[model samples]
Target: MLKKLLIANRGEIAVRVIRTAKALGYRTVAVYSEADANAMHTEIADEAVCIGPAQVAASYLNADVILEAARKTGADCIHPGYGFLSENADFSNACKEAGIVFVGPPASAIELMGSKRRSKIAMQKAGVPVVPGYEGDNASDDELIAAAAGIGYPLMIKASAGGGGRGMRLVEKESDLAENIKRARSESKQAFGDDELILERAVIEPRHVEIQIFADRHGNAVYLGERDCSIQRRHQKVVEEAPSPFVTPELRAAMGDAAVKAALACNYEGAGTVEFLVDKDRNFYFLEMNTRLQVEHPVTELITGQDLVSWQMTVAEGLPLPLAQNEIELNGHAIEVRLYAEDPSNGFTPQTGPLHIFKPAEGEGLRFDTGVRSGDEVTPHYDPMLAKVIAWGENRDEARRRLIRALEDTTVFGVTTNRYFLSRIIADSKFGAGEATTAFLQQEFSEDPSLQPAKLNIRQLALAAGVLAHGTVGEQAWSNAPATITPMKLDTGESTVELLVHNKDNVLSCRLGDQHHEIVLASIEKDTLCIIDNGIRQRCQYHRDGDSLYLQAFGESWSVTDLTHQPAAGANGAGSGRIQASMDGAIIDVLAEPGQTVRQGDTLVILEAMKMEHPVKADCDGVVSEILTKKGDQVKRKQLLVEITTN
Candidate 1:
């Protein structure tokens, strides 16, 4: 076993790798950007190094800095975790040249699998089923149009070097092809530094099934079964599970065989994943291969009862195959939900704030991989993924139940997250019936604003009432003389709540409508309160800036403004305004400029943020007055990008 290893990444994945490295009696070194100087992963590592500023390119993606950190820390191996340079062939080669183990597949394998076009060609040559599309080098527009016609309508244009759903466009008609292709190319170049693209037939209602394959340098390889990752938003997976409910035993065996073949074709070694797109007819086609550990690898670990990180270390240490194909057995069912720092009610936009309270559920067969803690700030400069919660049970239903329970019990305050949305999804009737597809969120949940809380005041009231019942009001408590007891009334547009408080013996009792409850005072600070109610404690953090009370509960935050105090006239200014940039990003395209007359719902501009492109559309019929930002210009949130003059 290695004595020490350096993790060349950040966030939950870095923390995850550290835990396993420590379990194997290896000292861990964590590298951090300026923003992550006080992050949880850095605090947990045996030694930490500051690499560069907050920008990923200056820190996490800086190969020279990472290698220098490894050399300085005396680490024998460097674990890329899952993102950053995990699959960068050059980074792998650099580690090898520096005489440090990369703890992943060989550089050649990464190079072959990292490019989608090249991977498709290799899979096709190896006799593996591939999607019908064009992977040729011709970039002519006419050639692409011909390829699309041959592949039929409703094809997908994807970046050849894309991952995490960036640089992909779905074209259902020929008329929409040119613009989408241009957008995809621009986004692909901006995201991956590669503008190369490939077109493929869009598989309708497909289930994403991926096989985890491990190989030793000695020409031995084995597949650890399959994981179903059909629950997604914008082509990015949100929930994943091992031993898919839809995959039959025979189909699993066949996919496993094909995955092994793909690995052997590249002389692959260490850990890698072969992803496939399974259509409604159960026909599977090779999608691509990930040449490093995946974000959802916990599900596979749960079912196999194997520590994949340890295995990676062993393989890097030149150990031969320890388990044969026949010796591996599919155990129980396991499911994982990725908790992101995003607001589901707002098109799942990314959110940033301090994590005032962070708590993870604990129980049998429950696992949590996290990177942040209480008081840590989640910045917008990195991926919004907060943590991965995994649950294992005897079967799929039991596993789903456990996962839902775990998600409900897990609490995060100070920023918005998708905890409630995830709970709703896992408990949905269709999801429970095993009828999920890649379009699950878009078709059933995305457009339905009613599925999410229109107002979080009810939950906020519950938490606040719980806090007031706990007598933490300090010197503001009512005097022995009959003092004027002020009743707190909260309105949420749909409902109203009034709380009556009585305090004695450092304890508080409150009447909430027809129910009476008691609580113990924990602490009370400026603008926030913490309390214990009926032996179950919950922390309620709120800010009373003037008449507005911002309440955050269970990772979903909302503001309750006092309607009694009306806003000053003309506070918002002007009669009509053009839709502005909602967040900091690069302007990918200007679909409409000055003097262009457009109607409501007409696309005006495309803004790319966090590697995803968002289309900003006209809200009303108007003629464009000005276009302030051009394509490739970086913009800030609420910056004026366009102006319109209504007729």
Candidate 2:
């Protein structure tokens, strides 16, 4: 066994690796950037080392610095958790040359599977079903365009060297090919240091399922079922579950065998995942292979009751397969949802700030893997994912129910989150029927009325006002409060909520838009508010910062701002024709220049955040007057990017 293991990552993944390695009787070393001086992973490690600055290239991705940190800490091996250099074939080779064991597949295996073109050809040679496409090295734009013509319309252009849905474009028509191909090449170059791409026929609404495969140096490998990750937005996975509802026993066997073959074809060692795009007909085509532990590995652990990380450590120590294929058993249903500091209604824009309140849910068969605390600062330099909330049960429905409740039980404040968005998707009708597809957001929410934000009635507004005014002061404030509560208005999204409040003798009442309700606060304890209305008790947890109030209860989480002090209301694009960034990020492109004319809905500026690109488009025909930020400049939320004069 190794004497010590150095984790070459940060955030929750690093924390997870350290914990497992420590439990396996190995000293753990944590490496971090300057920005993560006081991060959770650093605080929990046996030894911590500062590698470089905040930028990934200077810090986590600096192979030389990371290897030095390992040597300084006397680490016998290095674990590259999920992202960063986890799949970098060069990094693995460096570790080998340095006499430091790398806890992953061989360098040759990584290089083979790292190339989408080469990997697909290898899989085809191994008799694994591969999607029909072109993987030729002649990837000139003209060559790709000709290849697309032969492949047919609506094909997928994917980066040959990267995953996580980055550098992928779905070209719907031949006319859209050039722009998408260029964008894919640029993003691919930035993300993976490679501009080469491969074209594949897009499988419409296929279930994005992947199998977990473990192998050792002794020519042994085993498959551990599969996970369904169909719930997505912008081609990024949000929710994943084990033992997919779509896959049956027979189908599981076939896909699992194919995944094992894909691994053996490269003499794979350590832990890796084989992804497949399974159509409705049960036919599965090989997707790419992830050459490290997955982000959603917990769901698989919950179902199989096995420690995959521990297995990885053992396998890397030159042990044979821990469990054969027949020894592994899928026991229960498990599901996981990624909780991010993002806004679902506002284009899923990533948010960054101090986490004022960071209470996570706790219960049976529920787990929360997080890296942030109440006072932690969510910086824009890293991914916006705050944590992953996962749940398990005896069956799929029970697991789904537990997951929804777990999300509702969570309370996060100070920044935007996708908590409510996650709840709504799990409760979606198509999801309830086990018919979820990649078009889940478009098909269900676009057609469902109830999925829209809930409008507050007079009663709810009265409660909200009372919480803001009398919060932390207890119910006794009602006695000294004004008899006729002040008339106030709050701004929530596009609606301006106006109401008049009346507080007298420990009771609160409100009137607005032909409605009225009286409420009495029973008590207050920290952030929990217990109130009584119409002889019914409702206990809700809330957080207050200035005029902003975030409340969660009764299966809903709402954020309301007290705009009573403001003199008037304003729409999102009202009056000022300034185009502002919707999130904190770097400028990826300046699509329109000053003095340039643009039509309505034309993209003017492109912002990159959390590895995704968001375009700032013109709302009306206008001429660009100024550009506030240029390409490669970092920006903050609501920061002005451009000025346009509408004609």
Among all candidates shown, the one with the greatest TM-score: 2
Regions more than 4 Å wrong, model 2: 145-150, 172-183, 447-459, 471-477, 480-482, 489-498, 513-515, 563-647
Best by lDDT: 2
Estimate, for each residue in 1-647, the C-alpha lDDT of model 2 and write its tens digit: 67899999999889888888889899999999998999999999999999999889899989999999988888989999988899889999999999999999999999999899999999999989999999989489988999999999789999998686789998899999999999999999998789999999999989999999999988888999999988887777889999899999999999999999999999999889999999999999999898899999999999999999999999989999889999999998999999998877666678876788998888999988888878887877898899999999999889989999999888888787888888888887789788998887777675443345567666667667768657454344445555765787776544667788877765777778688888886666558777888999988788877767777777666767787775442333433457788767789899888899988778888887766788877766878898888889998776888888878
Candidate 1, residues 58-164, lDDT tens digits: the string is 99999999999999989989999887899999999999999998999988999999889999999999988999999978366667877888898899999999987
What is the TM-score of each predicted model, taking all chains together? Answer: 0.80, 0.88
Candidate 2 residue-pair clash tally = 0
> In each prediction, how many residue pairs overlap at the backbone (N, C-alpha, C within less than 3 A)?
0, 0
Instruction: Score candidate 2 by lDDT.
Output: 0.85
Instruction: Give residue 586's error in model 1 in angstroms.
Output: 12
Tell me how far the alpha carbon of residue 35 in candidate 1 is from the true structure, in angstroms, after superposition: 1.3
